[model samples]
Target: MRKKVVALVAVLAAAAAGVVVARGCSGDGTSKEARPANPNGEKPASGTSPEDAPRPMGSAVTIVVDASAPPSEKGPEVLFSATWGGSRMNELGRSRPDEANPEAPMSLAMDAKGNMFVLDQVNGRVVRVGPDGKPESVIPLKEQEAAQDMAVTDDGKVAVLDRFNSKSIVMYDEKGGVLGEVPLEGEGLDELGFVTGVFVDGKDVYVEKEHGPLLRIGTTDGQPVDRTEVPGRPTRDGLSYIKAGIIEPEAGRMYISSVDRATMQHRYTREIRQGSEIRGILLLDTDKTGTIYLATLLVQNDQESVVLSCHEPLKGIPTGTAVLPVNTMPEETFRDMAVLDEGGVVYSVRTEQGVSYQKYDCQ
Candidate 1:
């Protein structure tokens, strides 16, 4: 019932990440010397502010393929794939299969070492995958039913958005030991409702509550640090409310995705200043320069759904767009998405054939 729905949702979420048909990029045979440092070493203007100098737009490229496309031999440059339905289990890299208790693999996080963690919603646990893609450990929750989202710290600690109880970000050690839980403390969060996304960096954890505001919590004692309203137009219909966040510690950038009604799409937009107006209405990963992949279900267009990617930015401005092909398995519907370390995305799609793998390379 609920567990089955969660399993299905997990697979769909994988498809949302654009994991179909593995691909990779290669460099040309020539090399050039590095450019000299700027004499002024001046910082470029920010992309949003008029006072800031405009940043250079990088070149865009796309990779498309049919079902017959061959898988890469170099392992996945990026690993994004689907999960098993009705089982609290998921397969990684076609190698390791992990089983968490209660069988609800809702969210995923990976570390620099290639270790993966799956938020098991039904069993109220988080299962860790080792470097070899096998189950390493599981963090158990006593009463939490729906552990919705997750993020991994640079140090390998896991932070999770526990939706059912208090809706707080719970921190755990790499070995599944409980560190703390940060509770939301602000207006509109009294109910402690569902948290759709969780992101961790250093000792800070950010939680995005569904239909509510975003909360910043301390990783030390699970205390609320800051609360701010999300700046975006409210979505009415055909909206997928799976909010995802990524933090660029080096650039101090935070990227968040929300559903947009104008295009009847879910697009990722960057948030520069806290509570500031969000201007960049494009889909991009943390790198900000890679391919922009999208999973769409255009019900108005005869229920036609497919995974798509664009090398160019997709905002109010018009740019060239392209669609990547994937083999469709009956009964599978694309769901949510996450970018993997290897420059590819992992996505979950529904199919009668059960959960399967699809890899794409950004040309």
Candidate 2:
């Protein structure tokens, strides 16, 4: 089986001619909501290959966020409604001299129970929204730290990753209480900006090191630990670890593969061919049923848009796709997409009006 994939790699390499590694958030962005670009104005038929066809192709979720910004407790300063921002009043870093940018939310998260948690860093609080779309509560955060990323445990505890100030992961309970703080300043995790993701796998709290393997940094209780044996991002099923990567720069191509957690061997690899210019991978994740979801930024005909696609876990065969509008550079969500354990993804979109979340589900 490994030999077969190696042979496929050879063929792909030969086709590339000149290959270069590439990684990024997205390329030139547009404020307008994107629609599928089809000369016939129709989705690819079922007979189309996995590389072309996406079943139930690009079905838009009714949960589309309105173009106008909603109001929040922080007043209608023009960012997000429930999530506060754009003000310098009572900030933890207000005393600093070089403050330039307005306060905004850093990342997004959704717990298993279906509640949404927006990392409202500027407000120094995490806004919790119920499934019905009402603001439920706000989780207090360490004011001294400017949180970059965040993750929630299975039971609903929140962990915010602060890279510059505290250099630690502050844990919070489901009821908005502080659990503990796991320091991120030792050993394989020291250097500045080395850690990228914060995750809670089972009883342990893990962080991704350079988007490679998952490092066990502590427990869900915020107890610190130094371990680096995690094979990859552990899937919800606990049987495999999934990874996505770009193989060719000039060519719009990416490979998604699953690795057996126990053996640490590749289960399957599927290289999906894409647009004329590949911007960057926006989201790589899975739902409860082990169905893989991928969102990429691709440019064709000088127009850039995000393509959201889903794949089967067994062989990386694409299940479906949806072309989504992307905000022009200066991404408001930092670099994280919140994938709900139940079924879909929720990501914030920024425009001149304000910020709103775009929600989509895998069909």
Best by lDDT: 2
Question: What's the true lDDT of residue 62 in model 1?
Answer: 21
lDDT of each: 0.39, 0.58
| Model 2 lDDT per residue over 303-357, tens place | 7666666666665655555445566634334444667677666766655444566
Give the lDDT of residue 15 in candidate 2.
29
Estimate the overall C-alpha local distance difference test score of candidate 2: 0.58
Candidate 2: which pairs clash?
72-81
Worst 10 residues of 1 by lDDT: 1-10
- Tally clashes: model 1: 28
Report the C-alpha lDDT of model 1 over 50-141, residue by residue, as the tens digit.
23312212122122223133433454323333354443445322112255322224566667576766665555676776665556777876
What are the TM-scores, per candidate, against the unseen true structure?
A: 0.51, 0.72
Error of 2 at 18 (Å): 19
- After the best TM-score superposition of candidate 2, give how far the Cα of residue 178 lies from its true spot, in angstroms: 1.5
lDDT of 2 at 267: 77
Worst 10 residues of 2 by lDDT: 1-10
Model 1 C-alpha lDDT versus the unseen true structure: 0.39
